[model samples]
Target: MNPPYFSENSGCKSPDQSALIARHEVACNLTDISKCAAYLLKHSGRFCLCHRPERLCDIFEALRKYKLEPKRLRPVVQKDYQEPWLMLIEATKGGKPGLKIERQLIIKNQNNTYTDEFRSLYREFATF
Candidate 1:
């Protein structure tokens, strides 16, 4: 359920139509996504999505507004970057309020190779 990470008004528009639609809220915004998720998920079902770190607050607020309680968060960082650029989140429908923050998921090591964790995450696609 990864919705567009950028607000329609925030970023520079891309020349490519597909990229523009995929990257920005031209079609649907976070609140729209949250509401749809709530409607589709059964009680206690989990909804997972990845979004930018800067919008974490907004993400949480939107989720909660639709009665989806944030249950887990994992920050994704690249090696050598001090700040996290992405956030992976999981929320539960009609869940109790408690957020478990997991350790950072590093995408690359200092040697510029993918981290073991990252490799394992996409191992199924390696044969391609």
Candidate 2:
């Protein structure tokens, strides 16, 4: 954690900069984010992402357009029966087309209780 590395800037410095662009879109949009990752990754480099479910189609399309193949996908929801508001994905640059859809992640039980795993992950937090 160096000061210069964290110095506040109006825009991102490089396409290789990960996470920040995807999370904040501060200096770019979704299209730019995918393009940046594609440019920064090698032929088989992997990219992991968590994004709003509404953007699922867009995400897939972008990845394909950039030659980043979707390899895995998982939906995250609060309850087993609830619609997923977020999705987790793993894509590989120049990877094969086969995709593995992982099991859904339910953060809470039907009674709205946090699962043991989530409780452990969010230790010391009163509410989340």
Candidate 2 global CA lDDT score: 0.74
Q: Tens digits of per-residue lDDT for model 2 on 1-128?
A: 00011112434555555655434445555566578889999999998887877667877897898899999998888988889977888999999999999888889987788887667867887676
Clashing pairs in 2: none
Summed backbone clashes in each candidate are: 0, 0
How far out, in Å, is residue 7 in model 2?
A: 28
Q: Poorest 10 consecutive residues of model 2 by lDDT? A: 1-10
Estimated TM-score for each candidate: 0.93, 0.69
lDDT of each residue in 17-67, candidate 1, tens digit only: 999999999999999999999999999999999999989998999999999
Q: Which candidate is the best by lDDT?
A: 1
